[model samples]
Structure formats: structure tokens, C-alpha cells
Target: MEESNRIVEKTVHTGQQQQQQQMSSSLPATTPVVNPSNPNLQKKQQHIEDSPIANSLPTDHITDVDEYKPPTAEEIRRLTWKRDLRIIPLVFLFFLFSFLDRVNIGNAKLAGLMDDIKITEDQYNGALSIFFAGYIAFEIPANMMLNKLGPRVWMAILLVVWGTILASMASITTGTQLIVARFFLGVAEAGLLPAIYYYLSVWYTRKEQAQKVSLFLTSLSLSGAVGGLLAYGIVRMDGIHGMGGWQWIFIIEAIPTLVLSIVCFIALPDYPEKTGSTFLTEHERKVLLDMLRADAGPAPENDPEFSWKQFFSVFKDWVVYMYCITVIGVIVCIYSIGMFLPSIVRGMGFTSLNAQAMTVPPYILASITILINGHSAARCGERGLHVVASVLLSVVGYIMLIALQGDSLAGRYVATMLITTGAFSCYGSMGSWFTSNFAGRTKRSIAIATINCAGNLGGVIAGQLYRDNDAPYYIHGHGAALGFACATILFSLILKLLLRRINKKRDGLTGEERATIIAEEKADNLLEKHPDFRYIL
Candidate 1:
């Protein structure tokens, strides 16, 4: 039985009320009636339509054919603001702390971390690389678990688990211990980024997604800046308790994540369908549901509540791999910068503490650029061009870093800014692009997890790129970064062309042909290949 049918049948309530609740909780949010063929059932639906709840909803604008004239621009703007207030702040803080904990090792290294741990440069690199081992291995499984357990319970659990692991890092005395802790830290932290992306998709439409995701991606930049400033102050507490500044950075930063775990459990909502009346009024809930369903198109009659076959089918889609390939190089660039920026700045002749401070300006510029790029993409409804432009900028930056003379300090610093801005901006535009292209919920979930897991192989590579032995003008590191950024541009253009070709082919089909394809796919219980569905370019 479909999950929605099972839900309606099992609930011990009046049939009309059960149908009403089911509409609130069900995917597709199809029009609710006890039964279309029964006269009594039709009356029940009419009763609902006449009720105060339905009266306050946008149903007056809904036509008999199930088309709803969406909320006006002003109404959508107001609702979006309300949603932003509820969702963005908490997730933003969660990712901020999560990223800080992950990358503060760069700051810690500046505070004599390797000296205290007594590790060689190769061992330090091994420690960095191993984190992604756990991260990549667990990402898909973690997202699957998230779907099973729901975001609130699973996210809160992950937060606490990763926080405990991060705090434990302060006591490690050997490179192997650091490697082990960092690995588990990756294991515990793996679910966070992909899960948050999926969660945001649940709330926002495609048009709203790029800007919202960019807002969230800003945490990466903010965390970099925040991590640098915090390290500047906290490292000054060195030897206060006979611990190195690196140790203090680990211990102190882990505290906020632990606190936020409680907040996540108490406040983070799961899905629009699952939210209680106190969380969202009936009118607001219905409007939100209508907006989403209208934007995505109504679910087909044969659409299942969930399908394992569809979940696994993402692997068969060639576009999924294209997404994976496009992101791999971008991930390498992002991880390389996040994990090594402070060290890179120090190599530019700044003092250890001053390097931490100097990392702030580039991240600040990148954050601003991300917000602007995101809004522009969302407003213009263009992805490939924005992504190409941003990454092209990074390519230029990498070229400058590799080719500039050693004495050109100002030139090198400017190159870092360009790298940060371009690479960081890619996060939002590219992410929203691929995610919007995938069709069904389960398929999208698996595709996102797969693409992210595959892309994180770049993180493993990043750990090896900028070795301590290759400091100051690390030719190999800058050269590899340049090559990867170029690969991103290449794959992005290719993917864009491929999607456009597919969309153009679909557009050539007649209405009857399109209907036939949808019908056949529905018979197979697949939802992602509707001929009428157009990919976002």
C-alpha cells in the first residue's frame, strides 16, 4: 500500500479529519477526498472546502483541474522571510561551528600543533588525508540513515557525536592518534553538509534555492574568518593550563557544537508534512504545500509514497556522474584552501599570529562575492554561466599564484582573494543547479549523497597537495589546483550542454508522446524521467 493510504487508513479519527491531516503530511500534497467515486466522500471534500481552514488557504484561486494560482510575489516574499528566520540561522550556526572544528587544524598548525604532536610532514599529510577516508566512506550511508531517522533526531545525534570526537582531539600526543581522531571526526561529521542541502531542498523551491544555499555556504567563508579571529585570541591563552594554543583551539571550539545539539533536537523541523499545528498554522501549511506542488507539477496517479528501486536508480543516470565529476575539482580547491590558507598566508612573510588575522580579509571578500553570485543566479535563473565565470576567476587566481615572483607579496595576497571568492561562489550556484535537475525525492537524495561522496575524494587529494616541504611558492600545489579548477570548468560546460540537449529533445515530443512516456514510467514506478520535465540550465 502507498504510505499515504496506510497513514489515512490507520489513523483513528473521523474520515474527513484523517484526510485533512494526510494532506498536510503526504508528499505531492494531492487534493484530499475520501473517495472520488462515492457521493458521501465527495460531500466530505466539499465540507472541507467550506471549512474555516480551507477558507483561509489559497484555495479560492485553485481551479477545478487542480491548478493553483500561486501566492503573489508579496505573499511569497513574506513567507520566505518567515521561513528564512526559522531555518537559516540555526543551520548556519551548525555549519559554522562544524567547519571551524574541521579546519581549525590549519590554525592549530600555525600554533605549533605539529611540534607538540612530534610528527613529520608526511605524517601530518597522512593525518589530513585520512579524515576524508572516513568522510567519503560514510556519506551515503549517513544520508540513508538521515532519511530513515529524520533530520531532527539524526542531525542532533551527529552534532553531539562529532563534538565529542572533536574535543577529544585536544589530548592526542602522536600523529597516529591525530589521524585516528580526525578520521572519526570525519565519520561523525560526514552527514552534515549533504543532509543540510537536502533539508533546504525540502523547504525551498528551485527559484529560491540558489540564494538560500548561498546564504548557507557563506558559513564556510564566515567560519574561515571566524576561525582565524578566534584562533588569534584563543592562542594567546597558550600555557594558561599547560596546554598549547592548538589544544585550546580544539577544546574551546567543540563547546558550541555540543550546545547546539540540544537546540537542534528542540527546534529543528523535519518536513512540512510532519510539522505540527503549533509549528505552522493550517493556512500557512496548506499554502506552502500548494506552492511546492505547483512548482514541481502534480504527482502522477501511480507515484508511490517511496521506492527503493528509484533510490538506487540514480546510479544509472549519466548526469549524476557528470555532477560528480564537475564537483570533484571544486571540492579539491575548496578543501585545499580551507585546510591550508593560514599556512599559505604565513609563508607570505606574516608572523604566525598575524597570518591567522590575515586569512580574514580574503574570506570576507569571498563571503560577499558568494551572496552576490547566489542572488544573481537565483534572479537570472542561470547556473552554467555564473559557475563558469566564478571558476574562471579561480583559474586565473591559481595561475597568478603559480607564476608570480617570490618577492611579489601584494600580488600573491590578491591571488588568494580571487581564489577564495571564485571557488566559494561555485558552492551555491553549482549545488543548486544539479539538485534542481534531479526529479524525485528519493532519487535526489541518493544522487546528492553519491555526488558529494565522490567529490570528497578531492579532499583526500587536497591533504597531499600542499606539503610543508613545498612552502612559500608551492608550485606543485598551485599547479594542481589550477588543473582541477580548469577541469571543473570543462565538466560544467559539458554537463550544461548535455542537459540542454536532453531538454531540447524532450521539447520536440508531441503532447501525446509526452503523456505516453509519463504513463509508461509511472507503470514502472519511476518518477524522474517525465518527458515534460525540463532540466534547469
Candidate 2:
């Protein structure tokens, strides 16, 4: 009986050794073995390679198949710098154009778009609100298509379509035609911001993301500044060739987008693994892949097969809904300010051209505040406090707007600067906060789209907030903005406390208890629900 048992054990050992050898032989010839001296690094590398997602990838997609010697920290820094320089600027330019096209209707409105179309104030507000209806409807599907078609092809097509629509707005002579153009314009612009957010999330680590988000989003303010300058210049062309200044605004802004569409097609990188850019060497590519995987764990978008179950799973998380609420509150203020700042300034007694130019300073101040708050939040690794600070600042601004009541032009103008600065600052930190909490790539994509979709309802609210009858005071608008900002602060505090409680509970679990929990999560394919996965507050 003992001899028979030994023979069986020997046979099992031999089979296991053979399987291991077969697996090793399948890898590339130059692939290096994990160092025996560093047990922790070896375990981590094995964990990554043995993950289900990793195993499902094609052999060529595995970064571990390259030489295993990790790059030095300085080398990694240089590679990151090179990657950022190439990627951020191009996407920045694209988003700048996207934002400009979406909101330039405001500039056109001021330059006499409503008069040219003979539209009533109610019809104009309806046109504004209708754009967001198309925008909200198409976000999820557009992001799904973006994943399939690749960013370059998908974004270029979108830009060209929207730019054409914008240019055609110059010819619309009735409110109905303008409304139709605005809706299609919204449809074309839907995927852009969310797609870019997802793209940046894929490229950067959690610690690095807020700063990058700030840089990308600073374009919002920069567009305001540049758009203001451009509007001031273009509106002067009102009488030339019998075209209205509003018509000239649309035509001139549309030209750059059309031209940049061709540039985007040629310039955008698909993904780090699939990029064919001559600028990145094989070593740099491998290092980058390694860094990203280590920092954020496996991304679901990297999975080989599409799962409807995975796509729908994002809706089950309460965190997503909470994020949506906060975003809705923030967007209400932002869209309101974006759409009405010039008018608000004009109501404060500035000339039309001077009002366009005056929009520049507030936007510039907002841009500076966004960068500072984003950098500070990233450095401190605290998202909630930063967001709360920004909201409170806006609350102060709204209060001033209410109390001052156009009594002091300088005071009201300062309030405008505070409003822009405070509201814009929340975007970078808040966006990074929610994005980092999601584990899977598809979930992150859907979460972002859904949040933006829900949040855009704020734009509808914004369109109606400042009525023509309100005129100079607009107390209702100011009060409503103040209410939203306060709501954001409350929501942010609740979320932060909830995350803290959850983290404490996780911290108190025993090793074996945590292990079992992780095993259960893995079995259920719940990536971020693992005991080790802590939410960023």
C-alpha cells in the first residue's frame, strides 16, 4: 500500500513540472525570469501574470514577456514626461475646440443670433435646453462605440460632423432650424469629454491623474478667454458681406475644428499597448505598461471578451449615484455661469464689446484656481475637502451676487471672478475622485458617461434660471445657484464620511477573513469589492 501511494505522488509531481516547463517555453525567447532575491517583487509579478484577465490576453499583449528588468525611476520619469507631452497637448486642443463649439452659441447670442433668427427669449432657452437632451441621450452608446472604433477615427468623425453643423448655424433663419442644428450639434459633441476622461484614466496612475485632469480641464477656462477675444474680434465683422456678427462667429470658429479634424485623425494614439508611434521605444512601452498595471491593477477594457453583465454592473453601485448628484449640482452652476456671464456683466452696465472682453479675466482667474486646487488635492491625496472648498467659494460668490444686486459694478464683477474660479476648481478633483474609485475599465467608462448624462440636466435648469424679466437683479438665478452649491457641499461631506466608515470596517478585518472576502469577490468578478480595495475619499 505504501509503495503504491509513493508511485501515485511521483506521477503527480512529474505532470506538474511538465506543465510548468510548457508554460515557460510558450513565452518569448528573450523574456527574463523573476529574480529569486526579491520574493515580494516575484509574488507581485506572478500575481499580475496569473490574473484571469492577463491569462486571457494574447501573448503579444503581455508586458511581462519583455525583459523583466524594470526601468530606473528617473528613466520612468523621462518616459512619462515624453508620453504626457505627446498625448495631453493634442487632446487638450481637441477638447478646447469641442467646448468652444458647444458654448459659442452664447457668444453668437450676444452678437445678435436671436435677432437674426427672430426668436423669442423662450424659444432661445428651449434651443439651449434641447441641446442637452441629445447630449444626455447619446453619451453611453457613443462611449461604447469609441471603445470599438478607437479614439482617432471616432473623435475625428465627431469633430467634422459638429463643425459642419456649427458652420451651418450661420445660415439658419428661423428658430426651428436653429433648434434642429443645436440638437445635432449636441449629438456630435456627446462622447468627447467622457471619452477623453476615460482615455486619461487609462494612461495615468491615480496619484498622477488629478493634475492631468486639471491640465485637460483648464482648456474650459482657456476656451472662455480665447473665445471671448475671438468673439470681440469677429462681432466687428457684422456688416461686412451682409453677414451678422453672430454668423461670422459661427463661421470663423467652425473653420479651426474642421481643419483640426484631419489633424486628429493622423495624430491621436489609440492605447499604450497598441500605439505605433515612433516616439516610444519598446523599453519605454513595456515600462509604461508595467507602471500602469502596478498602480491601478487590471483594467476590464483590456479583457478579451465584451460582457453585457459587466457593462450593466456600474449601475448597482450607490457610489455612482452619489457622484452623479454632486456632478449635477456642480454643472448647474457651471453651465449657468458659462451661458450667462457676458449677459450678467452687460446687465452690470458694461457695453456689448466690453462685456465680451470682461469675460476674459474671470475665466483666467478660474483657470489659475483650477490648477492650484488640483495640484494641492493630488499632493495631499484628499479629494473631498478640495471639492468642498470650491463649492463654498462659489456659495460666497453667489451670496455677493444676491446682496450686491448690481449696486456696485466692481463688487459684482469680483463676484463673477469668484464664481468662475470656485466652480471650475471642483471639476478636476471631483472627476478624479470618482474615476479612481471604479475598478474595471468598462465600469469607469459607463460611470463617467452616466454621471455626465445625469449632470447635464443641470444645463436644462440653467437655461431657464435667468429670465428676461429678472433683468439686472436676477435674484432667482442667484438664489438657485446658491442652493445647488450648498447641496454639493452636503453631498460631498456625506460621501466622505461614508467612505471613511467603509475603510475603517475594512481595516478591522482579520487576515483570513479578508482573504475569504477577496476570494468571494474574485469568484463573483467584483474587482473593486475585494477586501484590499479601499475607496479614495
Tell me the tens digit of each residue's lDDT in model 2 across 213-310. 88888888888888899999999999999999999999999999999899888888777888765868886776666556545432343553445666
**Model 2, residue pairs in steric clash:** none
Best-matching candidate per TM-score: 2
Can you list the residue pairs that collide in candidate 1?
none
Measured against the true structure, the TM-scores of the candidates, in listed sequence, are 0.87, 0.88
TM-score of 2: 0.88
Model 2 steric clash total: 0
Clash statistics: count for each candidate: 0, 0
lDDT per residue for candidate 1 within 232-269, as digits (tens), equals 99999999889999999999999999999999999998
Model 1 whole-model lDDT (C-alpha atoms): 0.80
Give model 2 RMSD, 1 decimal: 9.5
Displacement of the residue 416 alpha carbon in candidate 1, Å? 0.4
- State the lDDT at 36 in candidate 2: 74
